[model samples]
Target: MAEISGVVERIWRYPVKSTGGERLDTVEVDGRGLAGDRLYAVRDGSGRLGSGKNTRRFRRMDGLLRLGSRLGPRLGAPQLLDPLGSPVEDADAFLRAYLEREDVALAREDAVPHFDQLPVSVLTTATLDWVRAAVPAAVVDERRFRPNILLRTPAGTPPFVEDTWFGREGRVRGGVRLAFVRSSERCAMTGLAQPGLPHAPEILRAITLAHDGRLDALATVARPGRLRVGDAMALA
Candidate 1:
């Protein structure tokens, strides 16, 4: 019998890669992952994808995190929001100005989502707490890791429990099934300065040195369905 492992504490979807994302009370899961997650990305003049993981491009694309993206009423259409949280009518101009690169343009993902590695990433609060204990100075926000699902593990569970979940099948609310693939690799973007968050290099260092540069677990959809906050996750 499957046992309760954790409860979904949060759901996040990034319409644009390397930028701010939207938090939802409920979301749909598919083979591609959350419906609007990573549907759009900023493509540079050289045709390289603008991602915080790509340090060279990301350095030039500073303040990318200040821009927020949300899906419009229409599917695959995203609305850009400025740092002040105001809708930007001319998204191209606004993004170019924000990134300080005239050659950069917002592009939509084609057949596949613009994911760095896996389609979905999951993290547990116990792991976050352990990281906070390791690096008390850094702000250990879930946004830094960019996880799609943040699960609240039972109190006192050992840190990095998700590591054990690798290769297992997780059922969400007895509907959605996810196959845990591997642990997510950390990147330089975790140290980048974002809105209300200061740049803290130690955050990445702590994960690298102690956790082998991995924290969250990556997964792919096994059975597409609905996911909501407070949904219980069971593993088989």
Candidate 2:
């Protein structure tokens, strides 16, 4: 196996699925993934979870990105916050009003995983640069991809460098080991409008034309431990 190394540039956790997430300086990685990541989501009466697309388990629910979730003073207790960062008094009522559908309500993941594919999503700075190079007119932001871990590779590193980490086990300086399963497939959600980003379908179009619509790595925790923004990552 080849050796690959870099520094953890950023860590993000989405308390609720398909919504804006909170960036952390440090986090705990357990068997499932980053603590408090995608444990809850807006579910409809038909049992389909709110998502950017319609699937057997997910329903196309617009405006989910307009909301944000924050971890309480302690982890595990996640609260849904409005875009402005105010706690919503009534989650169901707020969701109903925001989504404009009475059948929509907030729900937690049980029995099944709430993640789109894998528990953890990893994106590297080089990949973002690749996207920017492909679509220079569009805003290339990490939030558009919503990765749990953002790695900053050394200068002059080639784009999509994470592809080499696929099917490999990586150890972080903080002791978290992850097995990169596969490259994550990009979806329409990447083009959806977020707080600081506009609705840019060109980004997804460019990805589809250049990279078959895949942009990041999806992995699972191989060993539970801690991770921080400045931690070093080594892949074997």
Best by lDDT: 2
The digit string of per-residue lDDT tens for model 1 on 70-126 reads: 986455578888987888898889888877789888888876558888999999999
Give lDDT per model, in order: 0.86, 0.88
Clashing pairs in 1: none
Distance from true location, Cα of 204 in model 1, Å = 0.4
Give the best candidate by TM-score.
Answer: 2
Worst 10 residues of 2 by lDDT: 70-79
Summed over model 1, clashes come to 0
Candidate 1 yields a Cα-based lDDT of: 0.86
Off by over 4 Å in 2: 1-4
TM values, all candidates: 0.94, 0.96
Query: Which lDDT value does model 1 have at 24?
Result: 91
